[model samples]
Target: MQVIKKLKDFRTLELLQKANELTLKNHSNEITLERAIFLSWWCEKGDCAFCYMSTQKPRISDPKKARRQINSILAEAELCRRMGWNIEFLSGGYGSFSTSEIKSISQDIFKITKQPVWLNIGITNDLEEYGEEISGITGAIEIANPELHDKICPSKSLEDITNMLEVAGDLGFKKAITIILGLGETPDDLEYLFNLINDLKIHRVTFYSLNPHKDTIFETQPQPASLYYAGVVAATRIMFPELEIVCGTWIDNLANIGPLIMSGANGLTKFPLFKMFGTRYGKRVEEEVYWSGRKLKGTFTDFNSLKNGADLGELNPFIKRYIDKCLNKKPLKE
Candidate 1:
């Protein structure tokens, strides 16, 4: 399929406007933004060139430490619920936890709060038998181009990722896939991935702009232009009108939010509290205390206080501006 190649083309702008209208029409008045909690801090696939986790060693195994981490996540989930946000638990490290351990953790969380939980703990072959406590499964296929995937993630294969998605679908799990832009991938590569998504009946898609971490291989690489990112968001909506396209909150600049939403993204994934209080436990391979850190000095005291203090509400003005500009056909003043 022919795709939009240029970010500033007149045709691209028109399509973006159309997508914005479509999003408003389908979603009614409010866009559905979601929040997630990182179950752990590091990645098990420790060799991915673009990830900070790749620079670190795997976490050590300790039942006591694991229990504490689980408790912290549950506490945060409760806080998130009180904030009127349905929280998804993302397993940070790779699939270091065994199937039974994963299943038991999900069961524990669900039994306590009875809320939806999402898992992204890397590929586990026996996931289908891991029980239905999880609401969905997320597989981050960072780049659609096979060559790029192989180069950046030398530890994983595209085929394994595809099979994982297929297995998740076969087992009746809602599939959420992540596609990172500015990974040296072309529009055609995105089209190919979208086609695969359509074929697999994936439930949700989230877009992330490549943010090169300091210690990673791509640290010095320039981030993709905001306009290009916005263009991709618009094109994605045009291609999959009914699919839930999420704008990731990890984006550094708030200005990009307006153009991203205007280009038809209907969901935002954020975790301000998680960033403030969360701890990182790498995969099971090193010392238990090897990868643990946080910003605050005390225990989590108040959910409302933390939520209020966060800049999470910054998206509101951007959304309003995008809507006004769309309706009035006037350029939004930056």
Candidate 2:
């Protein structure tokens, strides 16, 4: 109702100000820098009309090539921990790994980092397999309308996506859903999105403006205007006051983040956190976050420690077992 009234006014500045005020009043002045450990770039059915991954369509999706070494993943998790990040997502794309593999990977990372494992590795059908080990699950609903989503992702269904979130929530995992702007979705579609989040008891809402990859079907589509993107973030903040709202950043849209921060985005995602070895990206990220007058949490700090080498478990026996398993020093326990 507030959002609708504000829309009738249609003044971008006022809308953003109200959202900013609401955010500061409810939540404090803080923004988080997110990190993800990629387990695979390969997607089995990479045919979404607007997907950046679809450009890499493989004739045959080999799971072996689709997966990354667990040792590398463990090291990255340790790096994130060293950087003072409480959580990092483990992504393997769609059909990149099996349930057993995911369970094993999640357990090892949790033991090593002591940070709750967040899974963004596409939709997982068997939430029961991971049980209480995994802390969070993401099932991105890029398109709000069922018909539109079906049209864009012919191989998938809204039911499959919603079921993943619902099951995760029921199983006591923090469930997050992503809504991508500039994917042929209108501002009006936010109403459906709001309703879905409310119904699902979603804990977080992530927003991204589509950054089309070259040679993809959506290559010609323009990204949502910065003002429009900020507007979406503002409306989401207004509607979901208690939810964690994160605005995703790409290199192209990095500078436009200030407007998003002011429009009630409490966090920024994909800040090239793993590239801490280079100060260029890190310097710019801190400067931008400070420019917005919000303190940045989880910025890379352990440059020397990461460069040298960080180990996860050296004391605890249980953690050492998982670490050994990830490092291929011992057989994985059943």
Candidate 3:
């Protein structure tokens, strides 16, 4: 508790550095990757003021098209698994589909990707209905400000979400949640947010800046300033040293990617994977991460020439040698 207060008092650089250090000591230099599958855009309560999904396009209106879409999605999932990407989580408007429909598609995804599926099914007692197929559950109170939550997300309930998390705990499922900052929430609200996380013993959190979408209630609400967002991220890391913290960002915000990495985000969520491998935005993200001296596989970075000055050559060899030394064996044969 004292440590959290001290973190609050830290200046920008100090706070970021402390968070980075804790991450390095507790986690690692490697940034894990995560991706979300949008099952459908048909949110029944499409009035989420801060969201644009409802206003964009329609998915649930055409059952045939939606069913065809799932086949393509399954192909993509298989390819991602082969390309070293983990289909970690699934998200969408569940209000339009029956639980059984979700279960069928979820099982299909798991059968191909061979990874645990973490889903946001929300406020239901039916997690076991999916059996071991859905191994994790998320109850997102994206807006935690009591004053604003009902106004922004009228269909969502804080008490119901609390109940959902408790049930997830009892089922021994991996539990996670998300929080969007800069919704006019106050300092007191932030304190309450962390306390709720502690009380729930959440296994992971995904943090996002309030991204005002077109034609929504907050269409004009400016995105949270990059530095302010980074500070909140750092505070989350400092508060929960070993907790899995995933940050959400878009191509437009790539400039702050380095600061976010240095501030203790262990993974990225909602990133566009389709554009990541061959596009300019993907290259920009790679350089930003490389400049931070963090390693990401498949980027083929040359650590030797990078200004961050973390050596690249022979690092893999050294890892082998370190293991050999532990076994008191001869030098690495390679």
Candidate 4:
């Protein structure tokens, strides 16, 4: 019902009202969503030209460093948990670690908290094998376009991602799928993706706007208008009412948020000023917070800032405003 093709004659007030109502329904409390970082040292073999880490490098410098990394991420997770966030997400470059590497990740975090942990590593060769040890792990498949999937990530094909979902879904693991809009994909791609997610019973869906990272082949490509993303989010939510949809990493600003929320994004990720509040180029919350303190505020360290930022209500608005802003988008004129 929130889906609209154009915003020319959009009615803003009504859109805001509906979006707020939906936000309250989905997220009853004012809490920040927990986020974790998984370091990806390299692109998988045959990585597309657009990937930031596509250069030749090992997935990780050493598995030994994983312990320190997990410790850092978990420390942040614990803080987020204490702050009332109900979710903990582990994000990083895919192809950076082996499946066995994730075993250690799961074990380390399990020692820290009982909160839900979502892994955002790209496609893998064998996720089903980890089912026995990774009962608590939530899986993510991050292929955006099937054609570009092969073009960009040849080592892992679209079929591979589909297979991962089928296997994970059948295994009864809570799953999440990511769709990065604007890779020269079409409406048909969206249809296929939505249908697959629906059938798989994926726990969540994340949509990322294609951002031109520095030095990548897509560096000069313009991000699609906010209206386009809002339409997709709205339609996706309508198609899967119960699925928790998220607007991730590349969302442009407070203004862009309104359209997406109205269109049906029930959940969102937040971070402070990436190239100013409303623009797309930015770092994740964990990275931003860590660097900000390490450089500017001598009194605070990563762990301390993690603990403190977790409790700060001001940090929650980036997410809240996104949905509120989406809700404020003028409704599509009938």
The best candidate by TM-score is 2
Off by over 4 Å in 4: 1-36, 56-68, 86-88, 125-145, 249-252, 270-334
Q: Could you tell me the lDDT of residue 327 within candidate 4?
A: 37
| RMSD for each of the candidates | 12.6, 7.2, 10.8, 10.8
Q: List the residue pairs that clash in candidate 1.
A: 44-94, 59-282, 59-283, 59-285
- Estimate candidate 2's alpha-carbon lDDT, on a 0 to 1 scale: 0.73
TM-score-based ranking: 2, 3, 1, 4
**Cα TM-score of candidate 1:** 0.75
Select the stronger candidate by TM-score from 1 and 2. 2
* Model 3 bad stretches (over 4 Å): 1-10, 56-68, 297-334
**What lDDT would candidate 4 get against the real structure?**
0.52
CA lDDT scores, all candidates in order = 0.62, 0.73, 0.70, 0.52
Off by over 4 Å in 1: 2-10, 58-68, 274-334
lDDT of 4 by residue, 1-334 (tens): 2233222235433444454456546643232333445454444452566566664445455534433344444544444444334343565555556777776676655554564356666666566656443542344344445666666666656666667766776767667776677777755456667767777677777777777776777889887667666666665665565667777543345455445555555544543321222122222332332332222111111222223333324435443433343234333321
- Residues 10-97, candidate 3: write the lDDT tens digits: 4657778989999999987887556777776666667667877557445456543433356545555554554455565777774645
- 1-334 in candidate 2: lDDT tens per residue? 6675565466667778988888888997878876667888778878788876677665444556657767767766765565555454677668788889888888987777766787887767778888556888987688877778888887767788888888888888998887788888777777888899899988888888888778787888888888888887888888878888888877667787899998898888766554432345555667788898889776544344433334335423433443333333222222
lDDT of 4 at 313: 40
TM-score of each: 0.75, 0.86, 0.82, 0.67
lDDT of 1 by residue, 1-334 (tens): 4446543353667767877777776654344436666655555558888887776564544323433355555555544544444554456666445678777777866765576588877776877666658888888788878889889888878788778888988888888888888878876676678777888788788888888888877899887877778778887777777777877645245456567777877655543433322222101101111121111112212323323322224343533332232234322222
lDDT of 3: 0.70
After TM-score superposition, what is the CA distance of residue 233 in candidate 3 from its true location, in Å? Answer: 1.0
Candidate 2, residue 137: Cα displacement in angstroms equals 1.6
